[model samples]
Target: MRSPHWKRRLRVVAEFVLLYGALLGADWLVTGGSGFVTLSPNPYGLPILVMALAYGTEAGLVAAMLSTAVWLSHGEQVAPTGDYLERLLGLSLTPLMWFVMATAIGEVTNIRTRSLRRLRRDRQAAAGDAARLDRAYQDLVDANRALQVRLAIDTASPGRVIALAAAAISAPIDQRRTALRDLLTAATRTDDFTCYRVEPDQTARVWLRGTAAGARPVVLPKAFVHQLDRAADPLSVTTAEDRPLLADIGVAAAALRGADGTIMGCLVIHRTGFATMGSHSSAELAEIATWLPQVLDLGAQPVAPAASRAGRG
Candidate 1:
């Protein structure tokens, strides 16, 4: 296969030959076969100028050289009819003009083309930056909203905290998990998390899951579950030793305990921004986890059978 560079070179050569040959044919016809390259206007210059403007300096130069070759091919008819020095000057004039014009026009065309491409590249870069800023602005808006929610809980008295928990528990059974997830998102300041419902067989099932954009879904590693069950408090990974144990599970996890103190479920936080993962948020997460089991327990209640509509029929 031929390279694109060679193909382009071949195409430029073909265009120069065809256009120059056509100009020669027209000049020959106009001069009644007196020959080409001998006319006052020197029609051969047109091909060089056209090629230069169309394909830049190299193409124009090639066309000029081709024109010179045509002049030589025409022999005495196109040759100078004068003394030695006069003949030498005449021979040089047409080729010089063609080369000069081709160089100037081709350089100008190249400069204009380069400027347009640079403008296009600048426009594309500006567009990309604007899109990124828009996304960052949206993230700031969400964080501000979550901060408001977190602050509301943080500044509340014991009575207010109890009231909020009561309100969540009183929500419909279907809406309970969603409320819990949203509450966690506000408290944690990050949406990348998972909630699990522990089955009777000691296996954890995905009761609810939430993840930020570009984040993978959280999967609770078995070792992480084992660690949560054994540890009385929430587990925070702050050392390399614990990292592998919680790999793919989350950065921290708290076991949801029932009134009897048996582990009923678990909440795993996969990621939270460094600014929000301090002692304050950690305490808030544990505090929220305490009441979460109460809300989770409500889901265990069996739903009443739908009322029969047979009477209407």
Candidate 2:
């Protein structure tokens, strides 16, 4: 296929040929003879000016060359009355005028075309940049609104878990255990939940062993720990598979994970009201477990030392 550059060149050449052919035909009708009529100003000026204004410097120069050829041909038909140099100088003036006018007007046309193209490009670029900025601003606004909603939910609840969690996060490393204990107690609304922290060797140590006055805390079974380890979220007594495993252990339970997604602890609620044990309550407990590592020291020593009376449940 022909490139655009070659196509444009061929079109320009064809236009010049057609223009000069029309001029030749007009000259023949006017003079009826070989030579041009001795008119004061030649008729070629109008056509050259039109070409220059329309197509810029290069096209104007091509037109000028074609006009000059026609002018010289007409001069050749004139009577040989003077010396060679004198005849040449007399014929040179009209051709010179055509070239000068074509160059000046054509140069101005080229400048205007370039300026308009540059302005169009700049405007398009500015529009694209503005659209990108608007999208970024909209994303930030959406994120801020989501954070506000989360804050409202946290503050509106009766538990005040957020306040206790904040206290745990800001408390001294030595005092973090007490803050975490308080946070969990308020979050669950019961003191009958057992908290166990997992050690590096995968041994579950009692962090806070909550026990009813006369009831002994049941020891966590291997099957229950295995289920909790595999669970992605918290498990509740309502779940069919978990219902059997959690029957004697608790109403709801969850595995506490660290930042790197490693299981760091386990929480088992040995007792809670029947009305407070459901999917929503389990989700709330799971959400609290999700942020435990961020606010509490998971690696600290156990809160309770004796596993005998509670049986490490």
Candidate 3:
């Protein structure tokens, strides 16, 4: 414990007086002025002992000194002997006794103070650690939410999936390239662009492409197509490079299936930013894919004579 300052000094003084008053009153009631000079228990010294133990050595010494002084002032009544040695012994011994008591009390106070300080420090450290863990937990939750959103967008529609596959196949032919470009653009919004496609053999493919006004379609190799093909649900590839590819190209593709569950062509579509493909988008895509075979069956018709001849040639 630190030494007591002036404020504590003043408090010690006040305590001394109150204790002295109580002792005086008790002495007066018990023995009137007759027992006042006796060396028995000085009730006034009790508060001093208590204060010394609570505040430490400095407070204890001050309380002991004050009690000694008060006892000495009442010396005449305490000692029957008018001898100087007797008076001296009484005065000196009383203070000595108070000092001993104070010292013992102060040691206990110091130990308690140290223990309390250690407990407080430990509690503070634990609190700080808890706060840090809470922040990390919140961050994880946010990341999970973002992932769910991305998955939705990636799997939203079979039309988009089919479109992406068709685009990859058509990109090499100049005349059909625009159709691929238009499909990719329509799949996602501006600023958040991604392109993905699948090969005719149902090998999933992905690429990065961007849209500009009246611009020709840009062709690039797809990344992580094998992983997508193996995944039962639509998945997002978030490697630093893959994220940019999805955002920039705005297209992705998957394999389309016929009513008999035979693999047909591929579907393709552009995606917006990371946030675009959320749970809702993925669900929509799944529903669309379920009905795709029927839609294609109804749309298919025989080619005209002129178109058939052109195709043969």
Candidate 4:
């Protein structure tokens, strides 16, 4: 596409040269030998103007020079001059005037061309910047959507905890510890914690334990049983003095209750080191505690005395 425009410009330049050459040749032939004529406007000035407009100042200057040369050659034929001043002024000044005019015209054309090119470049740069901004905005939108999805998952129903409670009740006394193990594993999927099933007799016993490397589990005191029985809702203790017995145990605690509003056992979730539970984790545990009694009731069944003793052991 660009090639054709350049070719057209080249053709215009060729035409200018051909026309100027022909006008000069015609004037030379008309002068009939002496090559001089009376001072008058050259007939080819129009062609010089046309050349300047079409192909810029250089072509126009070439055309003007040709016209001046043709006029001088004819003027000398008409009237021979021996005066050096007259001859010099006549020959030199005419071409110089034409050259100046042509140069001025060409500079104007160049200025306009440069201005247009700069404008085009500026527009292209602006468009590229706008596209880059659009891409960045889309990336931000995608990140926000992913964050929303994670929030939804974290806030979803507490069905899994309820299901675990159901399984525990149906399980034989021997298998009760195994059920507690599974529950603890699920709860500690995010952090390492120990699980203790505080029985109805006020004895605090470790049911399932999980520990991270270089960490030890702190045993809960029998005093915690009386506290668990008295608490109406899921409770958390984090102080080093109030619950000094759990001073070594870093973070939070939650209780699991039965259908008759009795404290079946307390599920103690400990967050050691930097690990801690968020509002969502606490809410999930409370929801699970609410459904525990119903789920256990559904799974209630007779237990063999030997199997019961095996479970406690």
Candidate 5:
């Protein structure tokens, strides 16, 4: 409405055309399309209301003024010569009253429209703020969880396996499995753990902690390898429905990868909650997986996270 002055000008012109056309039709009816029209049942009334609703009070006032002129001009042509003055003077108040009514209604309509628009704008702003607050609240919860995990890990050791895993991120390719074995052994609560090496030909080789060559060349189920092959991100499955393969060896796992994030293998953990772990064991394990990926992408030495205790706030 504010921009492009030409459009507003065009609207003003169109409003006037409609007002005058209606006034002419009304005049034709009163005058029988011959003499002149009487100023009863003002045709400008509808036009004035329309202009008010569309473009506000200023538009309505202009329309009212134009109607008043047409009415006065027609009154002269239609009235009888003698004693016409009295009749004209008697009906003089009609135009003034119509103008007043138009102005009053226009202002009222404009005011209500503005109020409704303002209400809508205010509601939209409030919704936007609510969305931001909700997002911030979630972020706060995650931060608090991370803080709790770090605090627990700092208080008591999760064993040398965790420490070695932390160090192994910077270690050479072959040694990462060695460090992972220690961590998964402590974490899985089982001694018969086997690390799998998925090959390019959809085949896999299983390795124990100290064993180099395998007596049993275990071919992974095609369905399981296909699923793991599709996974590009670290996944920890606890629920039964998550993976078809976890039903065989792993109940929950953190997928392992090479320095380039290629799916090398998985550090298979046991069920959701079965480690020689602290109270917040799930959060601690998550923290371990997040901070120590297959290979860390950092230029600086990793500092111990979250020393101070986090609060409910």
Candidate 6:
């Protein structure tokens, strides 16, 4: 029905012929060859409407012209006997009315088709944009995963090599201890190092200090625990107005945080000239600060600060 084929052409011809025949037969019955009234419906307009939708404006106009001829012929039989030109004009009015109506309907159908075609084009364009964005997002995810595979995390200190190796393995208490020491060694120029765990009871226990103070945990003062828990970054305080315990130790301090960002412990590196250990020292302290809690969680408690050749200065 939709194709530009012989069958389509045949369908149009058949419809026009049938519409003309039906109108003529209806005219004969309604007028009965003695009436002057048009009681029969103008059904030919329906066939013109169908052609406009099926085969477009050109086909509809053709149907309208043929139907108009049939309408004019029927009017001649029913219309009054009068002057030739006046009767001719009166008979032509039926065809003229039907032709104008069919043309108007065809124009409206053309407008509706154009709107539908434009809507389909817009939808396709939006779908294409969405697909492109999905492809770009997938590419970024794959690149990040590749970069993570190529990277290795290790300390800068030479003394910490065995500790890093030990921590890399699982199931050994000595390995855990070595890894914890590596946390101090990774920071910089260690003269002495200590690890303190923040207990649930709001007290701090110095788990290990220097090279060998391990018989019992040293419980810190209440004032020290209050200041330690609130610390946001690594510090080296030489002032009494702040944490005097850290000032007394003469070491730079950093917080050990878990994966979820909770501060679990503290590391104090006793390097000389602590007050002036400045930005470079602070960055080194912060870098090692990230690893201490992971080693601690693996049963690695700080043992002793081993002697080293490298100094942060």
lDDT by residue (172-228, candidate 1, tens digit) is: 878876666565565556678777876665567677777562354433556566667
Give one digit per residue, the lDDT tens place, for model 4 in 167-259: 776789788756755654554443355555555566655545654412544446666656555554444553334365445653556555544
By lDDT, the better pick of 2 and 5 is 2
lDDT of each: 0.69, 0.71, 0.54, 0.57, 0.57, 0.60
Candidate 3: residue 240 lDDT (0-100): 38
Of 3 and 4, which scores higher on TM-score? Answer: 3
Candidates sorted on TM-score, descending: 3, 2, 1, 4, 5, 6
Each model's TM-score?
A: 0.47, 0.48, 0.49, 0.43, 0.42, 0.41
* lDDT at residue 171 of model 2 (Cα atoms): 87
Candidate 4: list runs displaced more than 4 Å. Answer: 1-9, 18-43, 50-57, 77-82, 153-313
Model 6 bad stretches (over 4 Å):
1-37, 53-56, 144-313
> lDDT, candidate 2, residue 53?
90
Q: Please state the error at residue 46 of candidate 4 in Å.
A: 3.8
Cα lDDT of model 3 by residue, 4-70, tens digit = 6887777767876777677778878986744355546766568667787677777788778867766
Instruction: Write candidate 5's Cα lDDT for 17-60 as tens digits.
Output: 96677667866777564323443565556677777777777888
Measured by TM-score, how close is model 6 to the native structure? 0.41
For model 3, how big is the CA root-mean-square deviation? Answer: 11.8
Question: Which stretches in model 1 have alpha-carbon errors above 4 Å?
Answer: 1-7, 32-35, 141-277, 281-313
Task: Rate residue 261 of model 6 by lDDT.
Answer: 49
lDDT leaderboard ranking = 2, 1, 6, 4, 5, 3
Better of 2 and 6 by TM-score: 2
Q: Per-residue alpha-carbon lDDT of model 2 for 214-241, expressed as tens digits?
A: 2534346666676687776677877777
